[model samples]
Target chain A: MDKNLEKKVINYGEAIYEATYQEMQRDNNVFAYGLGADDPKGHYGTTKDLHLKFGKNRCFDTPLSEDGMTGVGIGAAMAGLRPIFIHQRMDFLLLCMNQIVNMASKMRYISSGEHCVPLVIRVAIGRSWGQGAQHSQALQSFFMHIPGLKVIAPTTPHDAKGGLIASIRDNNPVIYIEHRMLYKNAGYVPTNSFEIEIGKGRVLKDGNDITIVGVSHTVEDSLRASELLKSVGVNAEVIDPISLSPIDYEIIRNSVMKTKKLLVVDNGWTRCGFSSEIITDVAINCEKITCERLGFADCPCPTTPSLEKHFYPNPSSIAKLANRMCGGNIDWSPPEVVQHEILSFKGPF
Target chain B: MKNQFDIKKAYYLFLLIRKSEEKIIELYNSDKIKSPVHLSIGQEAIAVGVSLALSKSDIIFSNYRGHAHFIAREANLDKMWAELYGKSRGTARGKGGSMHLNDISKNFMPTSAIVTSAIPEAVGYAFALKYKKKNSVVICYHGEGATDEGVFWESLNFASLHDLPIIFICENNRYAIYSHQNTRSINDPIVSRAISFGIDAERISGNSTEEFFKATIRCKEKIKNNSKPQLLECMTSRWQDHVGVTQPELSKEEENNIKKAIKHDDLKNLENKLSKDEVLHIKKRVNKEIEHAIKFAEASDFPRSSELLENVYY
Candidate 1:
């Protein structure tokens, strides 16, 4: 990597902040609000300088009432304005499920396209620092289940900037889930306003072996695991599904056809998640392909680090799982596998 | 703007709503409509009174029992009935049945089935109206049962904190589903709760559409000067069940109270404001209109399978 060239790149959080800043400047109708939005930490730096840049009227903090505040956002959207409502943790989104699941998603259909609710709900998924069950829940799968709502979990800095701008511009309610750990991971991102199309997926690395599909943080791990598996006599293709609802299954199916194997990973529970969606698509399109799913255990997220280690999927653990499917030797240690934090987040939120 | 207060005209609107709801109850067993219907039969005056105060440019968000508001806002009766009939000609294109009826062109929002959900939504619309420097005001109407929901308090606090141009209209019919509010709610009345949030609030008789209309007009004036949220608690009664087209199972005393209330209902009182000839003329006109609306709904075609995904997104 060229050191001087690398200086132009930004991380996931910076991309998100820049996307919001640019979109607000582009359209006066776009405003953002939520709890901790105006706090000094600024929603883990994803919303840094937004309040100062846009003024208090545009970027502001809200009360702790999730259900009420979410409904407020919905109301604002209905009134010929675009709103970006943020939830610091995806876990707290459970408190406002009625508003999110029922009202926001059904606004357009119920109004016969008379009301176009252009709104975006940004929630931080995945975690670090023992946030426990209350602070750690990946709700992308849940949002994907909803019909009218669009769900996107952008993993890289470029996708963060492009995907968010797309969601802000999209004329429907979009649930934007960002994995907390991917915020610190740096990647190439343009400074100008751009959009990655909704219901589109990007292939990170192409290989002849089994395809590894991932969402949010799992995509980063899949990318790292693919590189490790290549070192061993196994080559794995890695795909990052940016959109969960209105998913682009064609990308995964195309990859699986060439690879003849699949491994699906998600930040949410393995039982009936986006992984299942991928597996079902493969089962329909492709024939006789071996596949496996990897995700968190089906229970509340544990607090202790030792238990937390078992809770999350790292590159090493994913590579180990991949090797079993592709008939490769298990390498307990790989210098390429990241041993440090992928999220680059330090928090007390 | 002191417009002519037409007693016969007001009764005509109320009769249209009453008969429309009655038609829904009669046709509900016919199995033409799939979704549940929440009728606001005797409580039409509250919505008619308050909504008549609003301009077509203004917006309204309402709860489950929204037929009265739908009619009060002057949404096409044929479309509303067609929506219940699951026809593409419906206001919401048959996507929303009784509870979710909306006319976007009329600036009436699709009603939320969840209680207290639309309260914050109205506040948000108020926030947008103020932000855009528009003169429009947003009003939210919900049943008394919604007052117990935490979102109701939160929305009031949010509205007052920002001084948004909104009004919250609560119809205290005293029952949430089957439970009477007197048995289930807090000792502090809802008006006091609104005042606690720094919102100006008042409690008045919902049986009088003229009184309710006057109060809402005054509230709109206050909101016009300084954008802020206000609350109005209307003492009303629902003659029907919480949902569906059947009569509610009430105690003998409760049933008697309803019967007595209906004897002096807004329509009966409102009739006294007009002559016997004028009242008969209005009733005849309203009945003809209701019959036309029924014929229109019955003739409208159900949605084709191709429309299953229409308007799911913009």
Candidate 2:
């Protein structure tokens, strides 16, 4: 194994920081601001040494007013500065909802092409260490719902640097979601500046049996699940759609055609989630596929270590689902889901 | 071109807003303007005074009562009327109605019904201008009610701290909807509140367009010379209701005092100052302008429903 691949096993937060730091160095317009970016005690140490290198003006701390600071970033973006705005947690991004959705996302449309807002907002998604409800929400799906936004969720360190580079160069606003769990997980990232094109999905493995599609940290989980299935004599293909919006459905559809079976692993809510979108797309495109399954439960992630084990899907869950779709549980009858109709109408007669 | 006043041009601007507001009220009631309108009939001086003092590069964030904004900025009266009529030629492509009328070419960003929402954004704009070392200013126009929003204070602190070029124009029109200014805050003089923050502030008669010019001139000079933010609280009054049709029932004494305070019928006063023939000629010219605007709006086409998604992702 190469020495570069050796560093790929580090934390995901470090990977995001490396990507941000590299992008800032590559582009003069790229800047980062949040709490602890300036202080030696960086929030996740992703911004460590940034203030020392770039000066406080370029990489500085904000006054805990997320709403005000976010608006400042939006304003700076409008003024021809491409700012990589960092929020410590994804949940805290809620504090600047108006700025993110109303101001940053809609400023270009509001200006009727008179102004272009190029902003990359980096947020840490986590269910980390009992921070519980306030700090555990993953909101990439919420940003994807907005029309003028591009969402990037990169699992590998290489893709992290590449996505950050692409986002900084894009004219429109991009929401870069960095999972806290993948910070130290390094990979073979290039030493120089380059862009990994956005809106393209990567096929990690090739097979003719079943397809497993996942995003962000869940991509790694899906790969592990595919390996477990392989040990049990099932060849499962895996794909990582780095860009959530403008998703490459053709790749998924092509893979599903060969496999005739699909499984989507999402780390977000089961209802109206990214997983739901993938499943619905596959159902429509590949109607005769042997089986389809979504691997997210309908509930908020739990805080306790043991309960969180049940909360998030593991390789075993993915493997079990893949096996079920392969008709491994032939003797067991599937539960019958009864359909119900309830209608209440109020009309002027 | 320098720091000088054009009194005649300034008077013309004031006349423009006053006449525009009068026309808006007539159209609003007559069903020509489908949307509810907020007329700044009595507060013409604030918009005219501030706009005249500003350069074309200087931006403005107007509130709901923005007819004065359109007229003061000398925006096309036809486009202004077309906007109110929901025609495709409107300032916001007819997507934004009365409250959201935005003309970016004139440097007036879209107005929001949410009070003080644009306050922090204005500060952000000023911050960018300052950071880029550009001689630009953002005139954030809000009402006394906006003071209640926490962003108002947040923006004030950020603007003053950074010494950004922002002119916080608080048009104190006595009432923010149903709530009176006194009911909201204990300070009778909000300008003094600005002084506490080390911001140069003044409390002036917002009704008098001339006073607004003087105040805004002083503010622009300060913003340019020192890059510090300033506050000008115009003690203005609205001639109509908060929104749509106004039924502001003033007593006989109140009406008499208000009439004397703002001198609503300035034509009558000008008639006393000039000849009756001159006043009639001015009225005749204004009527012609209004008629031209009406014809333009009538001829303009309404926006197609397909255009709803055209600019959402520009």
Candidate 3:
């Protein structure tokens, strides 16, 4: 359970695999399935030794049917198998809406807790790979909006491993999101297997200038911004709310109280994004935040590297905002806010 | 163990489907059971035959037109009617209407709506069986229209390549919605396509109970004992329109022709083997069972709204 004992700088993808493998070793009911896992190269080599070690029954390949496989996971979970389903790309999850939303999410409520479908669905969000609009979207919030689903996006190796282990052992269906870029990003993880409780958020770094909330790949940008802000004498505290659903609002609120200003760095699109919910919550519950700047990929993420850099929020953009907000010239009014009122019907005044 | 199947029980099951749907039709027009119904009136033999071949452990995935299939699987008629009436006590806690009926405890999964949807699920169930090295088989029931989905071909390929024990039952009710077999496909012979999958297949009269059972017996033998995956195309007819409550678009003469095929004598052909009293007793018993089911359903209360969110997760 100690995080310092394990090797540092391990790929988040490999860490997730190790975590899942350890869980599988602990329980015979734990199994994994998806495309490329059975292949020799194994899609980023996340599931390299799984098939050889666990045999084909535990580590199996599936035909290209996400809906069917998702349902199979649901049924298997009902039959006492802790199954983990993998969708190579996030967009492919659209095909399995009925399975995820209708069957998996609602099974517990529909069955009156007679049975729990404890299935884990892992998907990758690739932005810089030039996957274009269809393949590059970071749409984890879509599933997060679902009430019954427990959603998690672990940015570092430690959280990736710990979150996966927790999800496999949890008594509810979990949607595990991993970023394509963070797959190779390494961090220190515990040697012995352990579980990270789902729905609890972690504060990566503590400071007092401004609270920078980020998730998945954006966590790296937030940490980078924290470094840049520190160089400029503006201390920025970074919070990585790893689990998206059942989010630890307490940690977020506590961070906001110290900072007094909030910046949401998201990898998803801007409009109706996860950032919107954070901003709305801050507006309602906590002190009025200065420059609630939501840094997201500018447009539909382009496949070309040159265009994608502009799409995703870089350290420069986050640091610039952090410096500006800390400097006290903060304009919190969004563009949609009207500058002047045009009266079509003026009766009272 | 030689004749693991009981023919008398099979015949009784067939009579159950027939009597149940007939009563359902009577109740539908009389406004007692008020919901859109797809009565498997004439298609009882197919469900009965398919279910007879199935062990209690074997899984069956049925269609939206699945009253007979549910009854054939021995699902409680009271809960089924409760579901139709939108009572919380229904099979799906009143959430699933007629189309998305499922009783997992009984090993019957029916997606009462969504055409061609459950086929791939059945295939996946079969794949899971193979993955676990279980000697169980999955029986999938769909109309000829389901063949149009890409999942059908994909499932067929997966089943054949893996040698999974799955019986793909094409309950060819002659029509899908309003379109006849000719309108839906170029050829009416659905079984011919199954041969291309390099699997044993057949086409039998779905209306004939004895013939349907014989075909299913042969297919079940191939699926279970021989470890061979197969498909059985039952050329049956829907006694009612595409939906049961609505009047069929067929002309009076055309409707009568379909009804003629559903006469009591159509089943009485096998009655010579039994004495007059025995045949009469079977009919009387079936009619009594139908009356009891209706009474039970009528007495059942609607499902409480609290149960609506009970089965959404897990």
- Model number with the top lDDT: 1
The CAPRI classification for model 3 reads as acceptable
The local lDDT score (0 to 100) that residue A159 gets in candidate 3 is: 89
Tens digits of per-residue lDDT for model 2, A1-349: 6544343344455656666778777777778887667778576687888888876667887677777777777767766788878876899988888877877777665544556678888887765466466666777778888878888898887788778888888888898888766765656666556688889999988877889988787788787777777666789899999999768898999999988888888767767778778878888888787645554456666666567667667777777788788767634333222111001111110
Across all candidates, what is each one's fraction of true contacts kept?
A: 0.88, 0.38, 0.29
* TM-scores, one per candidate: 0.95, 0.87, 0.87
lDDT tens digits by residue: candidate 1, A1-349: 6543343499888899989988999999999899888889888787776889888989999889899888888888888789999988898899889988888988888877778678899998757677888888887788888889999999889999999999999989999988777777798886567899999999989898889998888888888888788777788899988999889999998999898889998888988788888898889889989989999887889977789878877787888888878876554565546546633445664
Error of 3 at B192 (Å): 3.0
Name the top DockQ candidate: 1
Candidate 1 chain A has its poorest 10 consecutive residues by lDDT at A336-345
lDDT of 3 by residue, B165-280 (tens): 78888888777777777776787477788778766788886367667667777877777676557888887777677886555788686687677776743345555566777777
TM-score of chain B of each: 0.95, 0.91, 0.89
Best by TM-score: 1
lDDT of 3 by residue, A115-198 (tens): 577899999876554577877677877887887898999888888998999999988999999887777677777777877888
lDDT of 3: 0.74
Clashes of 3: 25
Better of 1 and 2 by TM-score: 1
